[model samples]
Target: MSIKRILPLLVVVLAGLGALSSGPLTAQERPGPLRIVIDEGVIEPLPFAVPDFIAENGAAREYAARITRIVAADLQGTGLFREIPKEAFISSVTSFDAPVQFGDWKAINAQALITGAVSVSGRRLTVKFRLYDVFSGAPLGKGLQFAGTTASWRRMGHKVADAVYSRITGEGPYFDSRVAFIAESGPKNARVKRLAIMDYDGANVQYLTDGRALVLAPRFSPAGDRLLYTSYESGFPRVYLLDLGSLRRRALDEQPGTMSFAPRFSPDGRTVLLSLSVGGNTDIYSLDLATGKRRRLTSAPSIEIAPSFSPDGRQIVFTSDRSGSSQLYIMPAGGGEPRRISRGKGRYNTPVWSPRGDLIAFTKQNKGRFHIGVMQIDGTEERLLTSSFLDEGPTWAPNGRVIMFTRETAGAGGTSALYTVDTSGRNLRRVPMQGAASDPAWSPLLK
Candidate 1:
């Protein structure tokens, strides 16, 4: 099932919460309540307070404080929430079941309040939290608990934040997802690119490649167990499928005279769509994983690359230079004539279908400036989210509410870094990293 269908079920079953309403309330109907409406303009962040989680025992004290800070940081980073300073609070939550002082929070104009507790027993850790609408003087949702290994405390914190964010914003949760990207090092002339994965917040980075060969565009499988990326280890760009569990990788397409790159998985994870070049002519093709069967999908004279499947796997969106310049085109997944979708005044490339199946994100180049932008599937209502000397390779979050891409500075000493922007074109911020990075692809939310 899609994340949209599974999210409500997760809340009811895993979190042991009551059934959620059939749908989210509109902003006009829920005015003065604890909610956020993501619109097309500047949004006043909703103020919230996350006090230090209560430590049930001595062993849980440090974890409690650290998890509390991470939860608050996750919400604050979204630009939809503002964390009230702890020093400004008049009341403290000393116990997990203590009554909330709604009047104190209201005095500080806090629209939402979060309270949590942590306990550590041997190697296992448990966390529980509750969200409150201060204006209503009542709990927004029933309390939820999560138990896991002590080493996974960070994920536990993210789970709490995801619950809180979903409850307030009425949007799907993205905090628990992961991102795969190319980590860069060394000088601009001899840069070393390695495959790496990390939490959506840029934490818990784990390198998958040794930086010996250049890797690009690491796309995660629907199940998040494998990745498809382009590697230049064999003197030509080729697609490689890597088993994330075993850290083993092999070339997916090794035709003697053909080069294959820019691979993405079908929604079912049984087929792969990639750009294949033969005798200087590039087109899109599909490869079956169970059998080494290859079928060409595009037969144009011009280059057709960067193909992506729609959410239902029935259609595809790709970039082609057949229009005299790079542009976006959509066609049936089984191969047919494509219809152009982009009619803007720029060259569009790297179009990715949003998981929600509503918008397509791409990189645009116009008048010597690069930008990250999105548009409807029909190519209407085009909106550019970011502009820089170099910004490309747009990747959608699991929830389809945010986009992450690479941005490179100008000049010899310039460096590439990862940044994220919400669909509203607000909350554009740099993702914290130790070195240069690019080609980011977000994974589906963990099961």
Candidate 2:
């Protein structure tokens, strides 16, 4: 089935499912927000000490240390945990079951502690771990254990981070999710694009579509099982929703018009928000698959493209030239007065609402240079996240902690690639691609 083919059916399933609830579940249940979970973003990074994991049985000593390091790195990467350096540990974890020395840890300003035991029997590996609140002198929760193939040590490491994060922050786990984006190759004039999905860290890459036809703006559903993209296969630049798993596609021309592009799924996966252009004028609209109905949310003479919904699904933030110059505007999802939410020297386009619903990240064209920026919901506190010849198409990660977009250089041999940056505008990392890439839309945290 095509992505939007079951799109109609998925909406039915989602209505019964409702907004994702909180809590972690087994493989049978989907991942959702955790009720009464720790707010990792607001909470201070807990200082924790994870001593070198103790190897029981015949586990490789080298592999055990690597697993411990990966676990520590995952926790630290979330910006929610501060790992105590190996030298700072005045005490060592002699055993996983041994009582933690709260006094000693507290003296080193360690707020939490991690201890684990690893054992290997034949091809199977078993890991048991515990987390503790050092400052409170109490166990964080019951010890967690996992049994899997010995080769899955890295996955086991991520699981450890998920447990530590979930116990302290009420938020759901995101460590195990994956992301899909366009992979590019060939020259600038004749670029080839392929649908590339990979684990969040760029591991386990799978090509969903061959880089033959022209494709643009692909985004995954919240479950990461489907993708909504715009393809020119219809010969007139119409939006086509393709099921990543089935190599099937159906044109999303709910509007009988010739052009509909820049497609993205609403947070609930019930509606697809995209732009419809007619007679040279473009506007934003929503396609309600369940009712087989569509609602034009923005009706203006000027161009209004790249419509993104707030996490609550009550309002939308989009790019419009209503002010004589392109800028960001926020309006009710049902259609109403739009308040301008972007300011400063240049025109803003492609405004994407962060999943956390606190900020609107967009591409700003200032002077002659293009830069990516984020602003408060009410249009206050704007900060640039990237700058260059052309930096555009900002997409927010599920946690709203990072922003991913495309960066294109200038000149005869212009270059473009996908890049991700923290909300702080730091840690700009270029994602690997065979050729040029653009219009990256980050997928919602998968269940």
Leading candidate by TM-score: 1
TM-score of each model, paired residue for residue? 0.94, 0.76
Model 1 weakest lDDT span, ten residues long:
4-13
RMSD of each predicted structure: 4.3, 7.6
lDDT of 2 by residue, 268-356 (tens): 88888889998889998888856758888888999988888888889988889988999888898887899998878899988888877
What local lDDT does model 2 show for residue 421?
79
Candidate 1 Cα outliers beyond 4 Å, as residue runs:
1-13, 17-32
Candidate lDDT (C-alpha), each:
0.88, 0.73
Question: In each prediction, how many residue pairs overlap at the backbone (N, C-alpha, C within less than 3 A)?
Answer: 0, 8
TM-score of 2: 0.76
